[model samples]
Target: MIEYSTLKQTGRFIIILGIQILILNQIHLGGYITPFFYPLFILLLPFQTKGYVVLLLAFFTGLAVDMFSNSLGMHAAATLFMAFFRPGIIRLLSIKTEFEPEVEPRIHVMGKVWILTYTVMLIFIHHLSLFLIEVFRFYELGEILAKTIISAGFSVIIIMLTHFLMGSARKT
Candidate 1:
């Protein structure tokens, strides 16, 4: 029997997945701007989550998206990389002694600057890895770089907007 918290998490995951597939996936602007809503799952995870669990979830999350989009394994590789690096990124952004034990990654708790830096770094890493993997051959390095940067920019904007909206609700 699953606990209530576990059930709630499962529901949240499903809802986010649906939003990613049914909504965000259709908002692509040519090949340059793809809003990556899946990263929110990674960003919203509990601060104290285990590394392995994070990695597995990231891999599966990306794989699921890939499966739906027919993008092969690129998303899986990129997301797994982000998940693997997430803890380290948190540590790098964190003040260590000042970080709350059970806090989630939010603008309210970590401050806007920290959250912005964290999102930008992770989004860049994820987009770089994803486009590199998709392009495989470096013959189109310029194109891939352009796509990655543009897509990352759009994703970061969406992420910050989502954070601000959600944070405001939490404050009220």
Candidate 2:
């Protein structure tokens, strides 16, 4: 039988992807900001999850979005890059303390500062890689940077809000 956590995560994966493809993908602020809170799905995975498993999940998650957005493999590539560095980032952030194998990188569980730093770093990496892949032009570096900064900022806010809402909802 499937574990409860497995089922829960599967449901969340579907929901987040649905929202990204159906709702958030439609929003483009000044053509510079498009929130991709879908990365939060990857960020929230359990610490014990194998690196290969995380990479596979990230690939499929981003591939799903790419299929909808028709941006080729930009999402998949960006997400893969982010997932590749997730473990190192976690280690860097928790240099003084060790996280439990099953502990997820959630704001309430990990504290605001840690979660903020974690989310910001990963989101920036994902955004920069994504925008760079999308543009693929050295001359447009400035525009890409602008988009990455603005989009990462917005994505971080949405991710934090989603975490708070999910955390509170789970309490009741």
Candidate 3:
């Protein structure tokens, strides 16, 4: 039988992906900020999840977004890049004794400041990699920076809100 946590995680993954594909995909704010909260799925995984598993999940998640967005492999590439750096970022942000078994990197669990920092760094990396891959032009560096900053801001906000909502729901 499937474990409860596994079922919960699968449902959460489907919901996040559906929201990104169906809802977020349709919204284009000034054509500059395309929020991608799908990364939150990767961010909130259990702390003990294997590195290879994270990479695989990131690839498939971003591939799904690419399949819908038709941006080729930009999302997949960006997400994989972010996943590659996830362990390092976690180490930088955490003390050696910080994580307990089954703890996730959620706002309520890890506190607001830590979550904010974690989200900001990873989202910036994801957005920068994504925009760079999408444009593939160094001459347009200014525009790429503009899009990455603005879009990362929006994505971070949306992802934080998701954490707050989900964290509170778990509390009740």
- Kindly report which residue pairs in candidate 3 clash with one another: none
Off by over 4 Å in 1: 1-4, 97-101
Cα lDDT, model 2, residue 151: 88
Q: Which is the better candidate, 1 or 2, if ranked by TM-score? A: 2
lDDT of 3 by residue, 1-172 (tens): 3387789889989999999999998889996477898999999988888899999999999998999998878999999999999999999988874566577887776789999999999999999999889878554899888888989999998998888888889889
Model 3 has an lDDT value of 0.89
Poorest 10 consecutive residues of model 2 by lDDT?
A: 95-104
Alpha-carbon shift of residue 68 in model 1 (angstroms): 0.6
> Candidate 2's residue-wise lDDT over 62-102, tens digit each?
99999999887899999999999999998888864456667
TM-score of each prediction: 0.90, 0.93, 0.94
Clashing pairs in 2: none
Off by over 4 Å in 2: 96-98
For candidate 2, report its TM-score.
0.93
State which candidate has the highest TM-score: 3
